[model samples]
Target: MQPSDSQLTGVPQTVIIDPNTGLPQNVVIIQQPSSGPKIIGILIIIFGAITVLSEVISLGNTISFGGLFLVLSAVNVIVGVGYIAGGYMIQA
Candidate 1:
């Protein structure tokens, strides 16, 4: 009979070893996810949502600026969409 390979390490499996026996253990360790990115992503997503929702008010205010107002207001929407995408990308 021959020694088998570890699921994760394949050959010469030295990943999770039993300290007392000094032999590889069939155990897998999973670490908790960091909350930093989640927190930041949520905040950024919220800010993006706010910015997107507030466009109506912003556009109203910019109406007096005449022709350039649409372009300027569109910029705000684009930025808000970018923030939303950035937040999702950060999470990934």
Candidate 2:
């Protein structure tokens, strides 16, 4: 029988031989997660909630300034979310 084209490489079909040791070696790579962004996001969310609550308490009788509180709460929430997202994105 004629040797197949792949066999022409002179390497074994089921094994790889390392050039330095003439032995087979297995290597594994692992990746770690970043935790910064997630933590920041969580903190922002919590802080935003607190700020909104406080604004509500301070406006108990006045309904006219509701918009102000709404805006402030929205900004705080957004910032918190951004921090969390950033921390996670920067992790190695």
Candidate 3:
């Protein structure tokens, strides 16, 4: 005989069937929600700003390390800005 209309199709045979109705019971599907990326970007920017400020402050103490600090500070700022831009793009 052909399958009845009430019979479940494309459903796993292992599913628990209702005793009275002869159909799957208590089927639940769970899904995770998407989260945005913005806080990380802000943190990166803040860190970069702090590094640059510390480098500037150190410039007054020693001349030998000033060049290295300047380079490091610039790199930090650039990376931080890139992260912020990336976060904005992801949000959009």
lDDT scores for all predictions? 0.83, 0.61, 0.63
Give the candidates in order of TM-score, highest first. Answer: 1, 2, 3
Write model 3 residue lDDT over 6-89, tens digit each, in one string: 987685657778887776876466877445345665565566566656656766554565777667766765775675566566
Top candidate when judged by TM-score against the true structure: 1
RMSD of each: 9.1, 6.9, 8.0
| 1 against 3, candidate with superior TM-score | 1
Superposed Cα deviation of residue 37, candidate 3 (Å): 4.9
What total of clashing residue pairs does each candidate reach? Answer: 0, 5, 0
| Model 2: pairs clashing at backbone N, Cα or C within 3 Å | 36-87, 37-84, 37-87, 37-88, 41-84
Worst 10 residues of 3 by lDDT: 33-42
Cα lDDT for residue 58, candidate 1: 72
List runs of model 3 lying over 4 Å from the truth.
Answer: 1-33, 36-64
Model 3 scores a C-alpha lDDT of 0.63
lDDT of 1 at 33: 88
| 1 versus 2: better TM-score goes to | 1
Whose lDDT is greatest here?
Answer: 1
Task: For residues 1-92, write the lDDT of model 1, one tens digit per residue.
Answer: 56567545456835877887777865666999898998898889889989989987777678877688788789989999999999988877
On lDDT, the stronger of 2 and 3 is 3
Q: Which residue pairs collide, candidate 3?
A: none
Q: Score every model by TM-score.
A: 0.60, 0.39, 0.37
